[model samples]
Target chain A: QQQVKQSPQSLIVQKGGIPIINCAYENTAFDYFPWYQQFPGKGPALLIAIRPDVSEKKEGRFTISFNKSAKQFSLHIMDSQPGDSATYFCAATPAERGGADGLTFGKGTHLIIQP
Target chain B: DVKVTQSSRYLVKRTGEKVFLECVQDMDHENMFWYRQDPGLGLRLIYFSYDVKMKEKGDIPEGYSVSREKKERFSLILESASTNQTSMYLCASSRSRTGRGETQYFGPGTRLLVL
Candidate 1:
């Protein structure tokens, strides 16, 4: 049973266009939603995160639109650049402290910003 | 800066051989995890540990085992390597932030090939 599901295995967009990746979860207990970005050789890094209490959060050109009612979240990259072409993963966690096992991650989305 | 380091960036092993992958985290985090990433399978958790000598099995722990002898180190052991186990292995650590959130830090990842 995949706890979290992501759509569009691959995505391509113009250099200045916005690329959106969405994810949905079946577990309503999930409280923390985080997005990670992975380059070619490096590991996935924390790009942005959101909690269920907030509807939306923006940091610079990256924005996370979270809909708690729908149990869905999406990441939007504004003014996408060639540098943003990479793999993106969405993950969720239900742990409040450190007792729980770990996070549940979506498969992934390969995003390409065409220059 | 939180840093998680894996023992090797690339490794190759023969089938039926025992394989060991080590991970170390500089940050004094309470949680550490091991995951295998494939092309379409994304990141699947193998094992996790929250404290020294404490370990838990993740979603996929069929042929894998883990040891947490120290707080900063976690080791994943493959009882017998198989060709299907060839994949990118990633280690991550997370610390509890506030009361309801955690930020996971990942290593550079090790690419393993079992022939």
Candidate 2:
């Protein structure tokens, strides 16, 4: 029930195109969802995050679209560039309900942006 | 800025050898986590510590153990390393200043190869 399922094991987008990545969670208790981007030899870093309270949150070229009832969320990268190629992971946690639980991550989606 | 540092960037050990992966955070956060990353299995939590000398096992903690001697440092240990243990390990810590699920700072990651 704590699993966060992410789709499109990989993605490829042309320059200046918008790339969308989708994720779904089963545990309703989870309210905090964060998307992380990881490079070849680095750990996953927080790119953008959103709580269930807000429908969407935007940060520069990265944005998070959330649907509380649907129990689904997605990350949209606007104006994709070749440098945007990396592995993206969606993770969720239900810490407010409980104390602090580890994040349950999905099977990451590797994204490649063509120049 | 929060800083999470790992002991090594790459490590190689024999099958029956004991291994230790050290992680330290300068942010003095209350939460510290250890995860392993595989090609398809995004990031699987191994163990986490919420306070000094307090720890909880996550989903995939069967072959791993952890120690939190100090609040800023967390260590992951493999009693008897096996070949299957080869993977990229990550260290993360989160600051509670903002609130729960605010953000997690990650280390540069350490790739371990057990042969």
DockQ scores of all models, one per candidate: 0.58, 0.56
lDDT of 2: 0.90
All candidates: TM-score? 0.97, 0.96
The alpha-carbon interface RMSD of model 2 comes to: 2.7
Give every candidate's TM-score on chain A. 0.95, 0.94
Worst ten in a row by lDDT for model 2 chain A: A94-103
Model 2 over residues B1-115: C-alpha lDDT tens digits?
A: 7889999999999998989999999987888889998888889999988888989999899889999999999999999999999999999987663366757788999999998
Residue-level lDDT tens digits of model 1 in B78-105: 9999999999999999874345667789
In model 2, what is the error at residue B89, expressed in angstroms? 0.5
On a 0 to 100 scale, what is the lDDT of residue B66 in model 2?
Answer: 98
Q: lDDT winner among the candidates?
A: 1
**Which candidate has the top score in TM-score?**
1
Q: What is model 2's C-alpha RMSD? A: 1.7
